[model samples]
Target chain A: MEWRWDFTIEILPRMLSAMLNTLLAAGIGYTIALVVGLIFLLGQRTKFRLCNWIVRECVEFIRSTPLIVQLFFVYFVAPQFGLVLSAWVSAMLTIGLHYGTYLSEVYRGGLEAIPRGQWEACRALNLSPARTYFRVLIPQALPASLPGMGNYLVGIFKDTPMLSTIGVVELMHTANALGAETYRYLEPYTMVGFMFLIISLPTAAWLRKFERYVGRSMGITK
Target chain B: MSTQNHPLELPEGSPLVRFSGVTKRYGDLTVLDNLDLDVGAHEMVSVIGPSGSGKTTVLRMLMTLEKIDEGVIYVDGKPLSHMERNGQLEFANEKYLRTQRTNIGMVFQQFNLFPHMTALENCIEAPINVLGMKRDEAEERALNLLDMVGMLEKKDQHPTRLSGGQQQRVAIARALAMRPKVMLLDEVTSALDPEVIGEVLNVIRALNSEHKLTMLMVTHQMGFAREISDRVCFFYEGKIAEQGTPDQIFNDPQNERTKQFLSAVLDAN
Candidate 1:
């Protein structure tokens, strides 16, 4: 269980390679979450009552249930339906769908934070609904929503280790494999935790700074 | 004798705005019920009343921010919120509605200026984008408007940095930028401090005197309303209980509601 400098140094290159895969997975998952969140937001805003209700229920169900269960279901249940996806695809799809629900609420909150008078002002100006949303609403709403969205990005980054469960050789899986081969849990596991803290801490700090910058610009500074 | 023989023509000045049997409701709750009212063209008409009297609703319904459960609103003899083809009420197309909104501009209790935009940018936004004026032209007009409001120096500042009075002035400039035929004021001064209220009211009074913009204001500031408004309407419980000139309503009140309202406002030290 004692830390060994030579062994840690020897495996550091392999761990760094796996770190690249982990970062890539987080990037893809975050991208999918961003786009899918907008889709769900649009679904909730649609006029049809049934569509709205169904989307609401589905989003609520997804939001309430555990992401691990959802991931397992997608990874396991799909093969029974005569379809198969690579572990990376399954992980991305699950993470995206899971976080999409939370992000949709963030989008909704941002939209609602806008005063009713803003919409009336747009109407008074005779802007079309499309222009109103794009030029006025979205510009304000996106900045208001960014902090929440940034938090989710960090959440997705931390959750990338879950990808290792489905056989994706991300940081956690690489640590596990290295530990088994070297018969040393302390070095690889501790190194994996350090790698996460190193990447995520600065990213979280950057997101906070970004949120402050946007808040100042939007006049919503705390 | 020659002048008499030639026949003198009387200048035509009557009600330019007419609300006919207008009713507003939220489900079973009636906010404005079966109301009829009128104001002469280029006249400043103030609606004064207690809370829930539908004074604000009158302005809101005119702006088409609220739908009428019944009745019609006409501006320069054109129907609002409905279409008339061959003298029949038909579903108006959105294009028609869009054109209709341009004829009327409104100011609210809240300044409602786009917070992210500078005062000049807020003034010019609608003209360039919605009215499709060239950007330079819009900016020029917006500058002129800010100059009129005496906020030309502060045009580059955002709304949050400006005082409540300045924000309201910018909002007034924004509303006037459209060059609307009818301007609706919904307690524009209520949110400002007493000292700042004078500045906003001064801008409005000047606009009324200089340009003759037809104005309908819902207000609680009885002194300002009395000094500026040509006529006053007493709205009580979703109806116009009485309406007349400021002299008639204030000096020689006829309706009990108007008497009670004036007494209350005057009595407040």
Candidate 2:
């Protein structure tokens, strides 16, 4: 296929507009994952043996399964069970659940990175368990978790293209639509790749800078 | 065990801290076995032992950091590990433990100051939140404590900014802000550089002589233990093998284990 400058120009605006839905999907999906990850984290932290085992197994199950399979199951399979969800809802739920499991591990590592001495110090101070976790432990955990958390932010963004398979009108979906209508595959597909590359590279850089800033702000010298 | 005679005499008025038949185990490995000890009001008691001798566990159990596997600990004449419900003994709940635990303060070997907070903030945190002291009052108390530990200039610095001895000093200050009746020092100087050990020890000596706070220290510094402690204990195999005045335990160790352990420690030094 010949490169067409005019054709690429004609399609740039449409692709740019589609990037909005892409960002929206990633933002909402990441927010959901962040909240859902905490719920799973609490499940892992709870003392009840049965509840902990069940949540742990569920997290493992979601993490082990591919995101695409989860998306298809939620989008295509739920209707037969009389629980129909919109394409956006299904894609969001799937992305959230899949990434939420991964994020929970990030949270777990962060929590574990804190020394056992910190908890004993809190106990020595006679702080309540709730106050101890919230006031002392979580703040310490965030500095350690920020890099992993930021990686997954970019990760969720990169993975948003998978939502196109389930008919979400994100960047890839719009690119596919333009290709089907115009009978030209080169420009839209290349633009999608170029756009993603530009966005992901800068974001990953900013996140690295952000990670150091968080560490410094938390008074972690190393 | 060299010193077999348990010389802990619980004075007429209820002693400040008492451990009776307290036992702790990790899986099948018993860390403390039927340990019985006492600290009178404003008394200075030091514990010295071989590595696995349950000395640190004594401080840990008093801090409520470890669960007692058997027997009961008493603080200010109240059962600590268990509660009486309808004349039946039951494991004490977290609420009961928290209420009972406020009287004790602990300084760890690691100087486990909260890294994210300023020294002043670390001192003020629990008093304001747990004690419900007004922020101004808490800060005032905290500043005074910081001044006492000779760390007033470093109050705004995070713990990471301080050296090991400095951090321990601030830890002592932080513990004092709670106004605990008893302080448990678990090798607080073990992590310090040799030169800085003097500063940390000086702060501790000041605390011992100037204040009436009952102290239970598990230390390896035989000289400091002799100088400061009213009584010194030698623990062997999860039990108090010997205990008495520092002179008795050091110069006239009663048990074979105590004599052998002291000689080994002296050789190392």
Best by TM-score: 2
Query: iRMS value of model 1?
Result: 1.7
Model 2: residue A64 alpha-carbon error in angstroms: 1.7
Which CAPRI tier for candidate 1? acceptable
Give Cα distance to truth, residue A34, candidate 2, Å: 1.0
Q: Specify the highest-DockQ model's number.
A: 2
Query: Each model's TM-score, in the order given?
Result: 0.92, 0.95
lDDT of 1 by residue, B98-196 (tens): 888888999989989988788998998889887899999999999999999999999988888899999999999999998888999999998999889
Q: Model 2, clash count?
A: 9
- Tens digits of per-residue lDDT for model 1, A108-201: 8999999999999998878888778777787788777988998999899899888888899999999999978978988898899999999999
Most accurate candidate by lDDT: 2
